[model samples]
Target: MAKASRESGTPPVERAARASLHPVPDGRAPASAEAWALIDSARQSYIDALPIAAAVLTEQDGDLVVGASNRRYDSLDAARPASQPMPIIESPTIVRRLLEFFARPGDELRFEWRYGDQVSGRHFHACISPLAQVPGGNGRCLLTLVDRTTEIESTRSLRAELLHDSLTGLPNRTAFAEAVDEVMASNDGARHAVLLIDLSRFSRINESLGGVAGDEVIITVARRLISTLRAGDILARVGGDEFGILLRLANGPDDAPAAARRIQSVLSTPFRLARFEVGIECAIGVALVGEEQTSGEELVRNAQFSLKRAKSTGRVEIHHPGEAACARYKLDLETELRRAIDQGDLRLAYQPIVDLAANRLTGFEALARWTHATRGVIDPGEFIPVAEEAGLIVPLGRWAVDSALATLAKWDALAGSAVPLTMNVNVSAIQLARDDVPGVIAAALATHGIAGSRLTIELTESAIVQDPERTTKALQALKALDVKVAMDDFGTGYSSLSYLRRLPIDSLKIDRSFVSGMLQDRDKVAIVRAVLSLADALGKTTTAEGVETIELSQTLAALGCSHGQGYFYAAPLTADAARDYWQSQL
Candidate 1:
């Protein structure tokens, strides 16, 4: 029991036994055999070992006296203490320094230091408490050495992995978020800027050369950016090809663009990769943190909004109140459009397409319309682009097609085959990109029992040219179903007569710009003539849009335009007016 207590640990009863060199008197010993046996079976553990490098040092004199120590004390510093009763200071210089911490009356002090390279992987933390008061009232102290090298190293490694980009050694998005919040919360009344540098067409490097070369380009960009920025600026790789920079203590909001311009100027130079000279373009969005932008998320969101504009215009965009309002309006329109769609608040306006040669109605192009009870009518020019960007164009386009088909079926029912008219529905590029467009159109036609020949699908030349293979395939499938396809806004897109020859298009609609300008501009007149002649040669029908006067209508008819659609025929009318128009025309 005594051997166990002596070897167990350092505690009050064990510490009391080491108070004096001599044994305690018999009367002072506990009255039980268990207690006497504890002291009689073994020597005090404290005096058994010297105190320099123990897990705990009980007491020390100016001369380095005895104390309780674990088995570590003997092997520490790789030196054993003297067998004679002597101070540890007489043993080694390192031992003397360890005992010196508790020599004076002071609070506990923590120490971390290393010895020579002999204990390379080990770190010693010395916790020294001077003149510790024990139950026996001895003038003792405690000193402990703990090894925590692995723990500290692991913590540091984890932090670095979480906060830094491995390849570039730049701070990652996590670090950027924290920095943005800290800067926003600082409230130092100094403007800070966040610029998102997005590399345009950066994938060309990987596609043209390889991914390794792409990595080289990324590193080169990182180095160029770091060199271009001021010392206090921060640069981080927040995305694969996007770099985020935080400019602290900007002089004004203009400082953001000025800093971005400097970095952009540096990046404008071509990067010389292995066996390739690659040029790069960057779209920079600069957002200044202020009262409205209160967080990293808001800052990045505003910057992203600016980036979209920068990508289009190929210039730097500073986030302003106007752009913020525009972004908010787009979001508002998206919500309202979704509601309009779900509630069937959307309607179609029909603009009459006239057969000038026959002097009668040929078809009507269905235009989608939306009117908010509070805000009045929303223009298709505004909402259509917004819809496309939001990926809502496909759904809205399908609905418009379905509703128009059903309306056309009703019109045919009312007409009773007297002059059965074709109805045209415009399709966006996003709609045609889907493989299900043919299926959707077929379903709508079958649901209404409308002939595909009486339904013309008018699409912008640009939309068809975007993805020629997929679009051409979709168009061919429609043609297989006996649907007629017309290239709307023909001259505005980059497609040539050769491209038109490759597709199974039935007609070309001359863009309104040319039709509206042909009377004034000779080039417009020439473009009109050329489109008409080309259509006649290709055995395709021609439709002249934006005909506003009788004279212009006569000129287009003489120039071989088979159909015309504009204000001259009739403005776009509501569904009720359209139903009344077919009745009146009869």
Candidate 2:
């Protein structure tokens, strides 16, 4: 009857009834033809729909023997065809382990496994599930292989974009900061350091060369930085012209300085950018992270502060915060500057400007001085900029003009000679732009009973170059009052020649930098000589400032310079001292 059931494709119940009728004591039962057909149809459908390769393996002494494989599995290895047995040793380590575990005889178990291809280096994820057995049948393991290479590569690319600079493909600030945080969190015994690098004069380069050239310069800097960094050190671009570096597992503070020096050496080399050779200099600041628990943000801030200090002091690198005390002191001084001005603690010192050919004092240049209550005499370099930024310069400059006029009046009275006393007052661009400047000068001259010709207003090249047309009208108004006008710090700005030709000026004062350079560089000397000739041709007087030595003074005299003012003649003096010096000279 069972043989008849198998031949006729009877159902499982019908096959069992037939087997019972045979009454086999061993309980050997045959699967019905109907059940066998259903199993084959389900397996074929699953294999056809699955995108990944599917396979079945039998357990044998912790090894897998291939029982069945779909077309996809066979295609994965053309050397092995479906139903062809392959030893576990032929597969990768991960695959072999997965097969060994999944093939164990027990209830169904499932797990995820990864495999790497030896030939293509491609990675795949496999989901392994133990197959359910019929009442008395052997178990098998079902494996599904899914290719994960594309997904993995896409993930890696996204991470790279987040962690790296888009322009130079270097790590960015966020990534570098995270790395530092991780290292510090690990509490590594070795010392670590952060180096902050800021490009010097980058703004000037950007303004002069444009953004394209600037980008080239940045790329060159990145390449040089990469070359300079040692193993385990990471570099990142933090700002427009700022870079940060993290040196992991450093030896100590000594290691930081040496590393910083190497970076500086690399940066000092000239970079060739699009037909222009640009010499780049960087100010470096290094901070060490030792056993001290520090936040990454705090460390970065410290390094940045130190870098600013390095720039302000013109130092190559500064490691400690103490080096920045000068900047802090300047800040404090600035805070007190307004009070100084309000309290009349600020005073003007006059330096006698001598006529070179006549060998006589022609006028006085009014220099602002600050006498701090506690710090004694504060240098103008310390407080003048503060006053300017605080909007105190308007009042300060007016006071300077009034004070100088008063001093000139007093000097004339004491000397008992009209002497045609001229007082030169430095005027900032902001002051010149004020509509009341001409009125102020007129009022000052009227108050002091000094002739307008005896009062010279010194305007820096920057003042006129900033707005030539407007400055010209302002100067013309002052000149209408017969006040002498002199262009100060000449040859240090754009359009010096053009301004000289166009603007109404009574004198030209060469910048001190040019005057100092003229002593050593012949080109500078030639420039000075040419300026003097131009001034002569234009009927304009020339004053050479920063004549600190007798040689410089003599050189200016030989070059036909008309006026000179510098430490060589005399340091700026108090009003009384200047009056006394003029009397003695007379």
Candidate 3:
């Protein structure tokens, strides 16, 4: 029991309770003490049935007296000793609000209150409703406290999960946009930029190493990127091997490029993984925030558009005003290209490969051509790279192989084995890296009833140099299938001559740049002669591309080039035209 107040000669709660039970007035019958006790017991019983903590409070002398309460309500102060009376509303702020609610006849007050620390404490939603006034003593109110601690913690955990990336513990794309939104909303005329960094050739790492190694690389990149940022900047893992950075530039848009250079510098050093050390490069794209920007997501999208351009140009690119439309058009084209490949709607054009020495038709190079139903004749230069970047090249390559082989079969039936010509199909690096190229070729050959020797798989130096060991293995597999492998567009990429010695390269297709003006350009002629000399020494055949004139053809033949393909021979033709041309040559 609490000690009495000497001035009042009574305990505070007892005095307040006695003050609340004053006699009734205005012709009302004075209720018996027993009846009043029964009424109080019924109120206690009613509140005890409530799921949450509940109590009936009466206002006395600007303070709340607990007239009746449930056991749950009493448990709120369980830390206090059993000798002391239970306190109704411990928070003075809550008691003040309840007192205010008592003054209003029909008003209800609702609020949230915490029992202890802001972060690690119990939370409760407190609601107080005014009850009918006590007979001339004080107004009464019912207070209920619903514990919201579990619910609040759950919400906090869910929000954290949603906002954070599981792999890197950085902000994800969604959370980055929210942070960008906050920055935009609070912008005080300061310039900002979004830099999207894509780790170059990252898929190759995943292919050469495992996905776990790839994840390690991504985590390392995230950490290094964080090291290059200012205190106010935000960095996020927006993609598998791509990151987005939001910067509040201290010195306008120029700061973005500087930051990009800094990022590159940090990432320049090779990463030491579990097994081996590997080097990496990145392409950065920047989109500056402008007054005309609509939202944060739009800015991030613009940054992505710039990133796409950066991948192609191999430089840091900024988003221009009209780039969005260009990006959308490219997206639409990619969609159409995917649909075209799936439907077998794309066409193949056969360009003749001639025997330069004999001046006779020996084979044809299979070139993929798209004659869009609505937009006629899309250039291969336009869509080929698009297919490679969009990861549609595998299916596109498969379609090309099947179509070309089927065409060859039809031509063979027409020629009746009179002309034994080869069909060369160009293969992209993406196909070699991600697909079973030899298996696909074997299946296509079997399906078309064509011998593997008659099919030549043309590969660019870039394709071979991406993963030399894998490329060598794939080429060896193709060699096992007895398919001729020609290095297409040779001498264009940064391939070492040692690769030529090590790889199972049977023929070299001299790129157009060396063959187009060999007669007029002595340098080009010398390069062609050297390529031919090298091919002859290596026991490999040489084919000259873009030999557009008879004089150039003679020059290449004199240089010991075995085959030639150019405008001088024939342009890429349709299935019927190619058959007619071959028959004419016979």
Candidate 4:
């Protein structure tokens, strides 16, 4: 009984765990007792030349009971205990599946593993394969290890390229969304905040100094923003010249505002780019994690919503449940306005321009009007900027031109030389910059079979000042078409004499702010008189635009204003009302 007890002293696991040398899977002949010496000699010569070092393991049972490991495998986990598990560490799920593959004797397992310490994370390469020629007979697997820091860096660099902006090295929008998704998926009930930093006038810098300068500005901004945030906070370039920041661990909702303020303070310093020192203004929108928001997409949209509100109201805005409702309203309004433009719900009202010398109606300017099917009247002042921002102005301007020209054609037929009047249509800077504008006007004139002389186009100085080269070209084309061009809001801008001489404009319409206060304000009177004298010297006529009283009208006439337009004659009226007034003037 004592002999039997001594025989069974070792556990079955320990007995099964035996180590033996095996052949390398180098397309090598099987490691028979006869070939061991030859294989060992050839392997030693090339082993150091290659980056890979391989070891063979034998699995005894289905329990991942590893048999023997070669020298290469021993070095990989030299820090691990000899009794510890094989396939040392890395991506857990991948390791588990690879370990389970031992059940199939002849099957191969190929995978890469990463293992390291705190200072150097996951910087190893490993691949495993099976080479057993017989079922359950010396079942074997091969593992290879490589420690190439260059390979590690190359892989990391490729990954960074995939996820980061090429110019600024900030995470791109896709990576940013993934981060937001990760935060939301944690579901640990920790509050998070997303802040969208929108440059209010980034386009001005782009247009002024060229796109190269714009790119430098974006890179500079990204570096400054990274420095502004805590180590846990994430900054990404989510748009052209727009940045998004995520507060990874926020104490409360107020953390978002404090972060924004710090960033704003940092940006208060000017960015020196090449030859120019530039300062930029930014509008910030913030959204905080709460019970109501459940997804990253929702959080991003809420931040964008806050951004729009901030831009509109000129302040930093935070997302509230009410903000969503307001966003829905704004989106609804934008969609309806688009449809209103396309479906002809937009129309024009005509206001008279009278000749002060003859005291007769000379022409009428067309002003845009819109009425909602459910909401009654919408003011132009409220919606015009919206139209401009949406790029709906070009289409809107075209429609207005067609409508005014068609009405003028009918009016000309009715008047029949008794009270022929010109038609004036307003054009926006968006339309002026377009190469198609002159073609549109030419088509409208042809469609109505009307003379271009009967059409007068009005433009503000701001419209002409931007993109002067393009503006001058469009004006030259209009003059070629024989249409009169009037610079509206003349004295309100810094209009250079050289600018006026460069274009073929016909008249100046003095801004009402000056005209309305001219009687009581000497500075206003001087501006009016100076504008009138300048127009005369330039051989261009002057139209006093806000003659609300008879005294103002007579004063404008005494100041040698060529025409007068405003409530002194009449407010803007309907087309039929305008027609009747022109008929009565005859």
User: Pairing residues by index, what is the TM-score of model 2?
Assistant: 0.49
- Score every model by TM-score: 0.71, 0.49, 0.69, 0.61
* Candidate with more favorable, higher lDDT: 2 or 3: 3
Give the alpha carbon lDDT tens digit for every residue of 101-139 in model 4: 655545565555545443354455556676644332545
Per-residue CA lDDT of model 3 for 1-586, tens digit only, reads 1211111223444544554466676656666656665666566578889999987777666656676677787787664334333343656557567756766658788998776656556788999987877566667778888989899999989999998899999999889989888877775424788999999978988999989999999999999999999978999998889899998789877898899899999999999977688999999999988754678877888898889889999889888887777777788899999999888788999999999889999899999999999989899999998899899999999888999999999877876762588999999999999999999999999998899899999999999999999999999999998999999998888889999999999999999998887788889888888898999998999899997888988878887899999899899999899988988988
lDDT per residue, candidate 1, 1-586, as tens digits? 0011112344645544544433345435433444534543343455345444553343322334434455565455344223323232233433544455545546666767443333344455766667535444334455555656677677878998999999899999989878887877776424678899999889887898888998998999999999877766889999999999988644676678788888889888999987667888899988877668756788878888888789999899888856677788899999998888889998999998888887678789999998988989999999999888888888899999999998887766776752467889999988787538889999999999998898899989887888988888888999988999999998888986777889999999999999996888999999999989899999999998999999999988888899999998789998768777766776
Provide the global lDDT of candidate 3 against the true structure. Answer: 0.84
Q: Which has the greatest TM-score?
A: 1
Please, what are the lDDT tens digits per residue for candidate 2 over residues 100-219?
A: 565455544444433334433555676667776444333566767787768877887899898898988888888988977876676562467788989998988899899988988898
TM-score ranking from best to worst? 1, 3, 4, 2
Select the stronger candidate by lDDT from 1 and 2: 1
Candidate 1 weakest lDDT stretch, 10 residues: 1-10
**Whole-model lDDT values for every prediction:** 0.77, 0.75, 0.84, 0.78
TM-score of 1: 0.71
Ten contiguous residues minimizing lDDT sum, candidate 4: 1-10
Using lDDT, give the best candidate's number.
Answer: 3
Candidate 4 stretches greater than 4 Å from native? 1-172, 178-193, 196-226, 237-242, 248-330
By TM-score, the better pick of 1 and 2 is 1
lDDT of 2: 0.75
lDDT of 3 at 507: 97
Name the lDDT value of residue 505 in candidate 2. Answer: 94
